[model samples]
Target: MLKIQDIRELIKAIDQSSIEEFKYEQDGTKITMRKERKMIEQVQQVVQQAPISIPQQVVTTVQPQVENIVEKEVKQETPAVKPTNLHKITSPMVGTFYSSPSPDSAPYIKVGDQVKSDSVVCIVEAMKLMNEIEAEIKGEIVEILVENGQLVEYGQELFLVKPE
Candidate 1:
């Protein structure tokens, strides 16, 4: 298994070299990383050269339409509004979420379950370590946002609670 320092060193080495992608596998663990610098550079080049090839009048006419389309896409991707009174319990690190301590066990908390601030709500496994996640707020669990064994990102909402 690669240590945290080793992973950081690998990232630095990849950044210094011209390699666009990297993959490493050891034991049962796998790591993959890629650089999108080339694609971004190409996009920037096209944008920089656009005004030179096109007439000013046509550019002015097309730019507004492009902006409108982008605006619409952004609006469509926005998530549904959350309730103002609910407190969100978010993941502290990127990891796999586990609802139960073991496969055969019941979940730590379920919908409508009342919990204290120090109550263990779930577990997030990162780098083969089982990290107990706390509620952090005295409340009733109103929702569970992720399923067992789901991959979760840092700051991603895992539960919504209604405060007592």
Candidate 2:
């Protein structure tokens, strides 16, 4: 039998890589993980009596005036400063963010702390595995965006770093 931690590590490895699905069987036990859940959900809906309706945000409209107004609002919200200069360390997958290796330990990095390209800044726990997140750039940490133990989405900015 595989240890719980070993299973967790396996799940984490599959989650991080480009592979979308994984399966394993040993001694009559089988485990499977699929990154794409939408296909599975659609299959489930077909089997069930109730069909799920997802509303589409896009609408066919003849009004150019409304489109212009929305475009203007979008342009105004995106400023041409600070954000472009800072390096964002984004989450690679959806998971729970952890600032430290364990609850009792000091956080991996804090604002103003120096980090190298290979420095481990934090951990993102997915499927029970603690996957260490690297800085991937030489920099000084500018901000820690997420709170400890918060659920984070894929590509969500977790930290801002001022690259050296």
Candidate 3:
């Protein structure tokens, strides 16, 4: 018989494991657990950052799983768009978006401002580090998609630019 504690322990084990899903059945009782895709991705990212050595066979097996996760994430993040001349400046990493270098300072760029390819447009703070985001394309700022100090995700659109 599976008690609530037993099920909870099983879930904890699964969360800590590399396996994506688990199932068990006996005496007409069945239990199954599956980790969310995002959780799996976060685990994979942490594992990649560590210098732990993995067996060749394990590496080969994990490659396909990682590719699948990346594909799913890309599909979810990308939206269909009608053909437009506007170029979008996107967030390079997940963080808190800031328009100005400091609270009292003017914003880096505002609507109708012309920017060069290397122009600093905004900052994104992650893990106490302030990352200056840039306009990778030469253009005029048409729209600002994020408000100052808003949380943003990787690849989220920050500004729309009409190419020069």
The candidate that achieves the highest lDDT relative to the unseen native structure = 1
TM-score, one value per model:
0.55, 0.51, 0.50
- Cα lDDT tens digits, model 2, 1-164, are 88766765776687688788788899998877666545644654564555434344443353575578657755754645665678999999777899999889999998999999999999998877889999999999988888887767778899999999
Worst 10 residues of 1 by lDDT: 35-44
Better of 1 and 2 by lDDT: 1
Query: What C-alpha RMSD separates each model from the true structure?
Result: 8.3, 10.7, 18.2
Worst 10 residues of 3 by lDDT: 32-41
Off by over 4 Å in 3: 1-83
User: On a 0 to 100 scale, what is the lDDT of residue 134 in model 2?
Assistant: 98
Best by TM-score: 1
Candidate 2: where are CA atoms >4 Å away?
1-83
Off by over 4 Å in 1: 1-29, 32-82
Model 1 has a clash total of 0
Q: TM-score of model 1 relative to the true fold?
A: 0.55
Residue-level lDDT of model 3, residues 20-131, one tens digit each, is 8888999998766565455655766675577566688877989888679668766755656734989999998766799999999999999999999999999998757999
- Pairs that collide in candidate 2 are none
